[model samples]
Target chain A: MGFDGDDTLWHNESIFSMTQERFRTILGGIDAAEVDRRLLEAERRNLGLFGYGIKGFVLSMIETAIEVTGGEVDARDIQTLIDCGKSMLAHPVELLDGVAETVEYLANSHRLVLITKGDLFDQESKIARSGLADLFDRIEIVSEKDPETYRRVLARHDIEPERFLMVGNSVRSDILPVLEIGGQAVHVPYHITWAHEHVEPPAEGYRRIEGMAELTGVIAAL
Target chain B: MGFDGDDTLWHNESIFSMTQERFRTILGGIDAAEVDRRLLEAERRNLGLFGYGIKGFVLSMIETAIEVTGGEVDARDIQTLIDCGKSMLAHPVELLDGVAETVEYLANSHRLVLITKGDLFDQESKIARSGLADLFDRIEIVSEKDPETYRRVLARHDIEPERFLMVGNSVRSDILPVLEIGGQAVHVPYHITWAHEHVEPPAEGYRRIEGMAELTGVIAAL
Candidate 1:
């Protein structure tokens, strides 16, 4: 069994959303939703160049701030974004409901691995703070969650795709890619989702649970 | 045989040095070397939080800028730093002397892996642009090139430590770690080095070559 970090095991996207709100407040005079749209656009444009993480997000926010403010942004405004980023980096890791109980229960019967994508240090820090380190047999903080990445990871561990199961929150990131590679997957919906991570659900061959509390039942059914 | 990407295969640290010079030029009133010292300090402090990459370096620059300027840094100054980051990320991949000829020479009769550490997208882009992608059988972009990372990479490929060989520029990153794990290593010195990657040479047990042109001969002797 593989577990996704970020929004699956803990609260992640909501923190980003809250940070975006702070950005919108700091850089007023632009439509709030428009600010989000532009920031997301900047983020997408920068993703290939910067990769994903708070540092990239902060850089994208700075880029968006300059774009929205017509290059007349204040130093303190940029400083505010930097501070926001640092604060988020320093934020406490709060585990989701039933995450500990579910992972603990599953670890007893299965070889559990945590396959999540993001900045290496950020993810490692969160995992260390999440206090679930002892439960996982391996931790793979990947750059992206795609079919190829999943295939390589499974191959590295000598696990067959047909026997592997992936659980996460994002359809684009965590679900479809695994299913595409002939691996089983379970999608547990989170309260908030990044627009970039949104995708139309696939037609078949995956499980969906409303929350992590239902995970054990899903596993038993599997 | 495994190769290190950044300084070993291509021109990398010089670009960072050029950027640091530009950073000094933009933020006047401080000694140039003093600027470098502070930037290095910020980088070391941020290493665990931000990880090693261009993104982390940019964040360190911003943090150092604010520190040096006493929170009086100009918005334009911050923008210039951001532009510096973008320019670095978009820089072309220029292979070092004899790198192509050496790797090409070695690839014919050996299993070649490129093991590099940094921002995933940036490293991938450099590798793709390096025009040497077809030569490598596997590309491992790790978060850090430590003993555990080397061990994992070797194990994932089912390569034993005695049979594995690593070649790179930094003693801290490439040589000692491989040697510690019973793997052969060749250290080819680069003209520039990052402060964080500098370390006192180990007592023994690794080959040191002057350039990539000599790599083929070293491998032949082995």
Candidate 2:
């Protein structure tokens, strides 16, 4: 069994959303929607260069601030953005409801792997703080969670795709890729999704559960 | 056999060196040594929060700039630093002399693993661009290459420390940690070394080679 770190196990997207709100207030005169759109564009452009995590996001925010303000943005505002990033990095990892119980229950009967994507250091620190690191048989912090990456990971652990199962919040990252590689996936939607993570729901290939509390039942049914 | 990526296989520290010089010029009136000092201090302070990589380095540079300029630095100057970071990310991977040949020669007879520490995306992209990826049997990009990390990696791959041999440039990261775990290491010094990677050379346990050109001979003698 594989688990995704951000949003799936703990409150991740909410931190980003809250930071985005702070970003809007920092650039007070600009329309919030316009700021968001530009920021998202900068993020998309920088994804290949910076990859995932707060560091990259903050860089993008700074870039967007400069772009939107025609290089007239305050240096103190840039410092504020940097501070926001530091706080985000220091943000506490809050496990979602029933996550600990579900993960603990699964650990006794199955090998649990925490496969996440983001800044390597950030993810490793979050796992340490999550207080559930010991429950995992293995942890893989990858750059991107695509089919090729999943294939490589499964092969390294000597597991076939047919026996692999992935649980995460993003359909684009977790579900579609796993299903493409002939693995099973369970989608547990988070209240807030990043624009890049928004994807049309698959018609029928994977299972959908309301929350982690229902995970054991789904696993048993499988 | 494990190999270090930065400086060991390709040019890494030199890129950082060039960027630091650029940073000195950008900060203008500040003493070059002072700029370097403050930047290194920021890097050390931010290491826990930001980890290692160009992104974090750029962030530290920005922070240092703000400190030296007393929040009076131009926003355009900040943009220039960001641009420097982007260019560093896009910098082409230049394999050191005899590296490709040496790595390929060893790959024929041994399982070559690339164990590097840095941002996941940055390191992965470097590996891809290095053109030596295919020669490696396994590639481990970690956040920190410490004794415990080395132990876990060796255990995961079913390798005992005595049977493992690591080759790298940094005594701090690649040699000392491996030796602490009873593993063999060969130090191949690079022309340029980062301040954070500096440490007193270990007296006797590991062999020191002049360059990658001498690696094959050292391995055979061992």
Candidate 3:
């Protein structure tokens, strides 16, 4: 069994949403919605260069601040942006409801692996803080969660793709990729998502549960 | 035998140095030397939050720009910073002199694994571009090159630490960690060094060679 770390297990995009809202207040002249759009644009542009993580997000925010402010952005506002990133890094990992119970239920009988993507330090820090580190048989912190990455992880552990199952919130990162590679997947939607992670609904042959609490039921059904 | 990817096998920190010079040019009115100092300081401060890689460096540059400019930084200067990151990412991977020949020579007789640390996407991309992928039995892209990380890799391969040999540029990252774990190491110094990677010279019991061309001789001596 494989689990996606960010939104699937805990609160992630909510932090980004909250930071973005704060950004609107710091750069007062711009329309709040416009600032959001521009920030997203900058993030998309930076994905290839910066990859993904809070650091990249912070850089995009700074870039957008400069563009939206027309080079007149306040130094304190820049400081505020830096602080936003710092606080997010310092933020405690808040597990989604029922995650612990579900994981505990399954780990008792099955091998559980935490496969996550993003900054390595941040992910490791969160894992350590979550106090659930002992639950996993192995922990894979990858650069991106894709079909190839899933295949590689499965192969590394000598587990056939048919026997592997992935559970996560993002269809793009978690479900579709695993499904494409001949693995079973369960999607448990989170309330908030980054635009980058939003994708078309999963195709047939995959399960979608309302929340982590429903995860054990799906696993039993499988 | 294990290889280090960034500076030891390919040009990495030189790109950082060149980018820093450009940053100095863009953020004029501050001492160029002072710009370098502040950039390094920002990078150290952000390492825990951002991790290592070009993305974090770019973020630190932006932060330093704001501080040094006293909130008056030009919008174009911000674009220039973004461009620096993009160009570095777009830059081709240049293998260090004699790396290909030496690796090919050693791989015929010994197991070679590429152990590198940084953003997963960036490291994987460089490995693909280096065209030396077929030479390694395994590739481990990790968060940090610590003693624990070395132990894990060695154990994963079923190779004892006493039989493992690590070769890289940084004394901080490559030599000491592997040495602490009872592995032999060869330090092939790169022309440029990042402050974060510098440490007290290898204490003792480590081989220091001038270039990759001298690597095989050290291996034979070991």
Who wins the lDDT comparison?
A: 2
lDDT for each residue of candidate 2 in A75-172, tens digit (9 for 90 to 100): 99999999999999999999999999999999999988999999999999999999999999899999998999999999989999999999999999
DockQ of 2: 0.89
User: How close to the true structure is residue B146 of candidate 3, measured as C-alpha lDDT?
Assistant: 90
Per residue, candidate 3 scores C-alpha lDDT tens digits across A1-222 of 999988888899899889988999888888988999999999998887677788788889988998888777776677688889989998999999999998988999999999999877788888988878999999998888888999888999999999999999999899998989999999888888788778988468899999999988888877
What TM-score does chain A reach in every model?
0.98, 0.99, 0.98
Ranking by DockQ: 2, 3, 1
Ranking, lDDT, top scorer first: 2, 1, 3
Q: What number of clashing residue pairs does each candidate have, in the order they appear?
A: 0, 0, 0
In model 3, what lDDT does residue B114 have? 97
Model 2 CA deviation exceeding 4 Å by range: none
DockQ comparison, 1 vs 3, better candidate: 3
Estimated TM-score for each candidate? 0.91, 0.99, 0.95
lDDT tens digits by residue: candidate 1, A1-222? 999999999999889989999999997788999998899999999888888889999999988998888777876678788888888988999999999999999999999999988877788789989999999999888888899999989998899999999999999988998988888999998988888888888877898999899999988987
Cα deviation at A91, candidate 3, in Å, is 1.0
Superposed by TM-score, candidate 2 places the C-alpha of residue B118 at a distance from the truth, in angstroms, of 0.3
Candidate 3 docks with a DockQ of 0.56
DockQ of each: 0.54, 0.89, 0.56
Q: Write the per-residue lDDT of candidate 1 for residues B117-187, one digit (tens) a residue.
A: 88777887899899999999999888788899999899988999999999999999999999989999999
Clashing pairs in 1: none
Decoy 1 TM-score against native: 0.91
Stretches > 4 Å off in candidate 1: A28-30, A158-160, A202-205, B202-204
